[model samples]
Target: MMSSFMRKSLGQFLATLMVIAALAVTSMPARADALDDARAAGLVGERADGYVALVDSNAPANVKNLVKDINDKRRVAYQKIAAEKGVPVEQIGAITAEKIIREILQPGMYYMDATGAWKTK
Candidate 1:
């Protein structure tokens, strides 16, 4: 017995999940591995807004480039999902963040919390 708002929220979350699944399947393994390596090396982190970010301001240029490239692709995916679901991109981002931080991110990886502070989990 879900309220209308709850039902709508659930529907949007499900749509976001489908988009994320599609992105995971379509993403190149080499690029995904590079992002994984950077996270393991503490060079980059996951933002709360479904984007990859630099962990350190002094991270190497290559790490910065990798984050930028991955984030650009993610933004496009989020926008597409948001439009199809009639939800805000930020909402897509938050749902994606939940899956990433809770499921995808490895133990040593860094992720931003609700307060926008990066934490290792």
Candidate 2:
């Protein structure tokens, strides 16, 4: 039903939009309280592999969903950075996780070690 030129143009436009969306999502700051509150409540913690994990198995549904949302966003950002740096996503996550554990984690915050044990920093 559409001409070749129109289809090509639409394809390019969609691709551009996807790139813009990805950039926007990656650049935007995380929403407040969603993660911080969960962490403070001992519902979620950072994993040594650079992902969010449930510290309390009995955490609320909202807290679990929050962890999934944050980790999904992080995966997208990591993929973008990995592509730009020509490195594996796992490497980026590992390095990022180390930095997070060493620098970003605050006192009294929880994080999981490589052995899957929860530790408070």
The numbered model that scores best in TM-score is 1
Residue-wise C-alpha lDDT for candidate 2, range 18-52, written one tens digit per residue: 43355356543554356777777777888976688
RMSD of each: 1.8, 11.6
Q: Which portions of model 1 miss their true places by more than 4 Å? A: 1-6
Query: What lDDT would each prediction earn against the true structure?
Result: 0.85, 0.72
**lDDT (Cα, 0-100) at 30 in candidate 1:** 90
- Looking at model 2, the pairs that clash are none
Best-performing candidate as measured by lDDT: 1
Score every model by TM-score: 0.89, 0.73
Clashes of each: 0, 0
